[model samples]
Target: MVPMRTIAHCDLLPDLIQQLLESNSDTHLIVCATRPEFLLHLTAAIRSQRADPDTAASHDLLTKTIGLLARSSKIRLAFCPTLESLRAYLAVLGANSNESTEEIRSRDRQLLSILDMVAMHVTTSEFSAQGLSRTLASAVEAAYSAGMDLRLYECTNALDPSSAVWGRKLWDMSVPSLNGSVRMRGDESTWGGRGVTVKRVAERWFEFDHSH
Candidate 1:
């Protein structure tokens, strides 16, 4: 029997996994602050491999990535944004019907579990965001509590009727900023009503801003 040697590359994945899992409040603050850049990285990574067939190596990579995300302190803070990314990846898989159904289903189950955990955290925690405004406000509060100073700016176009309706409701709830400057035009007006403009769901962004 020969002794097994650990190479640097062999340790890389595990090290990354540990770091992500052991992420602290400070880590969450950083994630909240640089969410856009983080998301862009995630998107590019996904797009780069979108055409690759699901293999054992690919599955392992995804599993490790998801595990890291699950254990990260930023999990709750970045839940929605992360979910959107996951949804995009899953959409790619879904579009490729050639893949094994069993494999796809298994991956879907795992993703759904992660999503459920996020929803549960939001529901159980004292940190709550009612609508877009409250959501941004809570994010800022969370970041500040974590001792991070960051600013976020968001511009959303509510083209979908469903999204516009919900956006309007969120606006009324005071969770979203209705500064009365952002306006909806053209076919978008049919979403809520004729001449009933939509407001910017988020003027100030960031899962958590430093200012309370």
Candidate 2:
């Protein structure tokens, strides 16, 4: 039997790309969140290592990899300028793709409509902040309606103790009802300042608290 294939988020490590090339001769590879410079470097490295006398086989591999990404349902690749944009795109894509192709396409159109509305509001420079927030809220609502999990990460002003306190408070308030858990990083003084410490909060009052 053929081994089950896997798809990984390639944004984290370039070495992952090399590993995929070595291990998965027939497996489809989809790369996302790659900068143009990185892509060029990868292409150059692959070309330099080509063993084929005519280099046609190596070129074919490159073409095939790109083609797989373009038409893959199991793999959705996207590049966004900001992490927020990436998160937003993932939320929409995840929600839409849980259904039939036609349904997914319809959801895509609706998402685009929401984006257009937000863009128009921004252009007018009238209540731009409110408009942007509304746009994000609309997108999140659509995601939730489609049964996708959407989460917004909290920003930390590391220099301010008050900011950290508020951040922890907000997390504490929000995490209790979630199916997943939340954590806080402990001070280095607790463990003799040797390594990182993480404190896991319980999702349910009945559950035990743990630390690592």
Candidate 3:
């Protein structure tokens, strides 16, 4: 099996998957958490660059090869930049309470770094919104004590885990707290509650569903 570091050959991803997953294969292929999703983005960029060699996008694409450069660079790092990527990594832990229902739950630590990176980019509007609570909460329930910095994000004032709205354990999100400030709150030791739902609620929103 060829170890294509960045998955640059987007078209070859299918074969790569087959080779890695086939029982008869003698080799293995490993990819970072973001590679699968980012591969789509990279493919688009490559296609755009190739479709019009004379276009300005083509000329600029030469130096702005996000996939080739960033994939290699980001994979080596610990954090992720977007909420989607963060959620995706967290989902990697397991669908429910991160109990390691399957072998996939073992990657919780790596998922933590993605949260840390997402928290850094998260804002008050996002933190307070009803959409992100469950996923953030699920991640909290996984290993709150170990991932304090990853759950709470502050755009202005410092995040207070004790008093922040997120601290209320507002699963239904019925509480209307005047303090718009957002912070990570809830039981951290175990993923006992409903935790984050892996189901897709919207393009970027994932709601918590206990059944999952």
Task: Identify the candidate with maximal TM-score.
Answer: 2
Model 3, runs deviating above 4 Å: 1-77, 95-125, 141-212
Give lDDT tens digits, candidate 1, residues 57-145. 45444455765555564433433344334334334433444545445344322111111111221212211232333434444443333
Badly placed stretches (over 4 Å) of model 2 are 1-35, 51-76, 98-212
Candidates sorted by TM-score, best first? 2, 1, 3
Model 1: which residue pairs collide? 133-175, 133-176, 139-207, 139-208, 140-207, 140-208, 140-209
- lDDT values, one for every candidate: 0.30, 0.32, 0.32
- TM-scores, each model vs. reference: 0.26, 0.28, 0.24
lDDT of 3 by residue, 20-136 (tens): 232232221223225544456345444544656565343433444554443333222333445565556555543434333343333333323221222332343343324355554
Clashing residue pairs, backbone N/CA/C < 3 A, model 2:
none
- Model 1 misplaced stretches (Cα beyond 4 Å): 1-60, 63-130, 149-190, 193-200, 206-212
Task: State the displacement of the C-alpha of residue 41, model 2, in Å, after optimal TM-score superposition.
Answer: 3.2
Q: List model 2 lDDT by residue over 106-191, tens digit each.
A: 44222111111221221222212233344345545554444332222222222232532222222332122121222335741122
State the displacement of the C-alpha of residue 102, model 2, in Å, after optimal TM-score superposition. 15
